[model samples]
Target chain A: MNYPNGKKTNNKPVTNRKPKQTPNFSNRGMTLEEDINQSNQAYLSSGRAVIHKKPTPVQIVNVDYPKRSAAVIKEAYFKQASTTDYNGIYRGKYIDFEAKETRNKTSFPLANIHEHQVEHMKKVCEQDGVCFAILRFSKLEETYFFPAKKLFQHWDRQNNGGRKSIPYQTIQQEGHFIPLQYHIRIDYLSIIDEMYF
Target chain B: MNYPNGKKTNNKPVTNRKPKQTPNFSNRGMTLEEDINQSNQAYLSSGRAVIHKKPTPVQIVNVDYPKRSAAVIKEAYFKQASTTDYNGIYRGKYIDFEAKETRNKTSFPLANIHEHQVEHMKKVCEQDGVCFAILRFSKLEETYFFPAKKLFQHWDRQNNGGRKSIPYQTIQQEGHFIPLQYHIRIDYLSIIDEMYF
Candidate 1:
């Protein structure tokens, strides 16, 4: 079979054994990062939005300037990002969000988010920017647009002996489920429109 | 003499040299970058604004993992940034700007800004984000907040027998002059408030 980007899939189907349940199209082994990137590209190309994933920060310690072409970094280390991964202007409002995927079936663990990121999101929200987390349950093939305000409520309650993880039921009830689309892939802005606009 | 950051001045005063006019206190031998960073830090601490300098992007080519320690990137290359150097949410709006310093006292050269950066700023402005360039005349110790709209006007006219640089007099007349403060350093936000608010 041929994929959308013209790469031919070579995984042969095994007909000798009993067939398993139909594959989950939503969880096609492509990560949430790739899906969101494709969606952002679509959004940018259509002039609908201008959102970008920030490059991973690396601290360079040394560099070598060899003759002409380009200077090469010889020593570096990955640094923790102080803010969320995605941010941009969307319809005259600042849009900022982080994305996380969890394999756990029942709950979204708090460990998935860094304290600094939570604090950053709080500041962004305080500035009245549209802030949220894109939570993906890979095992359940479900994705959600979880608002930062709701996340803050859970984050604060954890200090007073509340649950460390958000129960799947709460997410399903409160979070907006991001609908999957053909070309758009993860259609998150539609949810934003419904919630904010 | 001691500098603001506690570094001892080593250069002796030259009594034989012709007396140059008293040095501009605003420049203070500090790069525009350092000033902006200090300003941003103060803004963050005071809850006046949420702005940050984006990390310089590097492309990792190789990594080495030593026992019981974090993985170290052994080789990488500095990557050109696709967007402006600084961006953040301020006053419920997206703020993006690039800072440039020039020693020329007559005009700010167009060569200091990359074509792609100009395109990026134009796009940001089109999206209703407050986009501008912080132009510093290092020799004159004057800094101006040049709006991207005004910049685009000059940039586009360069093809039609227009000057290749923005005259210092024009900047003085059109751009908002950023004042230097003790703690705030380059207080560009005041200019933003005046223009945007």
Candidate 2:
């Protein structure tokens, strides 16, 4: 296709082209984690909330400190996380949640959520902390803020010989949809305000 | 010197000796991190609070995922943590703190803490989250729960040509001493209950 700026559609790799300054609303090719991270940066800068993704858990078996350089990990293995991926404080309340994305448009598979994570969420809920899941249906391009209580119910039902996944229609009814924005890609705080505050 | 287990005072390199089943109150050779982790586990099991120390941050540059085998990180580097080492919920309130130990008996040096961590504590305090530091003096064998506000005061004062470290006497007066116990090695939540609750 011809370009609007009077340039031909160049198939040659445009290595020197500068990145776009403004964000494109329709072109959301970024992963859910990246979107959430960007949104968290916006929230933190705006003094709305203070959320951060925990680093990937790694078990270091051996490390070498050579001369005056930085320590380098020689032998390490990734460890499974025992808690949710994201946590912080908002409006004097503790917030905790896990983010997950699936390509299945019909349902969100139960396998996406781990048992220990559910247990962690249960403990947080018992402590009266706000715990939930940010589930994204990638194929459908829909993201929802699903409550931990509802997830627990479904998890229990699955353990009791129920369906292994939550249907999209059920999620639409029970969960709050998070709309994308320019600055805050996934404005989940607005949903929290409406639901909790 | 000999132990009270009726064993001879033979120094023949006892490598096969069994670990003690009961905790010793006098001999605390474990690091402050281990002590806090043990305390957190105790609190979690008793359903008192849900606190966890964050895993050490690392930057992975290369990984090898062989078939039917776990992923092995071939190259990685240690990364500086942007936030405190530990945080979680206690009594429906957000709790955040950093645990640090000093071998020097005079003062807890500011060099142990990073600038970004102080900024993070500032943000957490602004969000009304309970923030503090667990300072331990190895020589004195004392641990104290120093409030974030107090730390910030000293931090800012140091920036304005004040002392670079907080004096040991100052910590004794301003901080709450965490007593070592058999079950909950470092009973910090007790101090939290007294100070915040």
Candidate 3:
């Protein structure tokens, strides 16, 4: 099949390309987490922002210390995080958010977020920090920046028999679509600059 | 030996004390990390501040999944963190800090801090985020909240053949001494309120 850009899509691998002309592997099949991490690194290097993905929480059950080697974790379990995935300072403002990708094309599932995370976001908002979620429609290759306030409004309505998931149409209308740039792959902060700043 | 309050200090276990009269295990022999965690928890519950210790980073090497049981992390190693231990929003400000304890009575050794952490703190400071270090003199039973700006000044001087460690006198004079409270424990935020607000 030919792409709109006139490039053929085929299973056969191209082997004639020179090493200098090789495509950037970092961007290929890159997960949202990897893209954000690289973008955060770019921001850090350029002094644009200081943000980091919090380490995955783990409960270590056992460890083994050899006589002359690094300590090895023998057994462990993943622990549910009490806060969002990403947080830091941006333009003198406290920035906090969680990022999730959904395969569904119609709506973003509420189950993807935890109750504690919602509570944490509410606390951050109460403290006047800029809090939000980066929801990626993986199948569509589109991403949206949804503010915490809007998320809370929907979450609160869940008890009142509101829709359990955020419809794609609502997200398309209400959410800020993040433009994928070459350097700043996920330029969500630009949206933040426009919305909050 | 007798304490100043006339309480006897004995190695002998007190068998006469009732279970209800026993001290809270959470507070006894608690490390600085535990104290801050408890304090953060108190602050969180009281609607005062929202802070959390970032999870200890771990690099998972292998995992085993049984048919019906939970997946088990069979092999892993602790990964060095790229950021500070604790960070969150507090009263419309980004709060970022690292907590350290030293047995040394006269100085806080700069070697305890990594070069990357210093850089991270510098970035946070540049963004106007409130950043600092919580230094605990365990032997002296004292903790001090040292501002990041002050830390940077000392850090920069080391390159010019200045002192490699912060003198006890300097910390005592420049850093805010956080008094250990009965319920609140490490009341460092009180000092923050006094300084920042």
State each model's C-alpha RMSD to the native.
Answer: 8.4, 9.8, 9.4
Tens digits of lDDT, candidate 2, A1-197: 43334444323221212212222344358889999999999999988899999999999998999998999998899999999999999999999999999999899999999999999999999999999999988867777889999999999999999999999988888887775555577888887887788
Candidate-wise lDDT, in order: 0.81, 0.85, 0.82
Tens digit per residue, CA lDDT, model 1, A59-141? 88888899967998999899999999998888888999999999999999998999999999999988999999999888777
Q: Which ten residues in a row have the lowest lDDT in candidate 3 chain A?
A: A13-22
Checking candidate 3 for backbone clashes, the offending pairs are: none
**Model 2, total clashes:** 0
| CA shift of A26, model 1, Å | 3.3
The CAPRI category of model 3 is: medium
Q: Candidate 2 - CAPRI tier? A: medium
lDDT by residue (B62-132, candidate 1, tens digit) is 99999999899998888888889988888898999999999999999998888888887877777899999
RMSD of 1: 8.4
Best of the two (2, 3) by TM-score: 2
A183 in model 1: Cα distance from truth in Å? 1.6
Off by over 4 Å in 3: A1-28, B1-28
Per-prediction TM-score to the true structure, in the order listed = 0.86, 0.88, 0.86
* TM-score of structure candidate 1: 0.86
Candidate 2 is scored at a TM of 0.88
Task: Kindly list the per-residue Cα lDDT of model 3 for residues B37-60, writing each as its tens digit.
Answer: 989999999989899999999999
Q: Candidate 2: misplaced stretches above 4 Å?
A: A1-23, B1-23
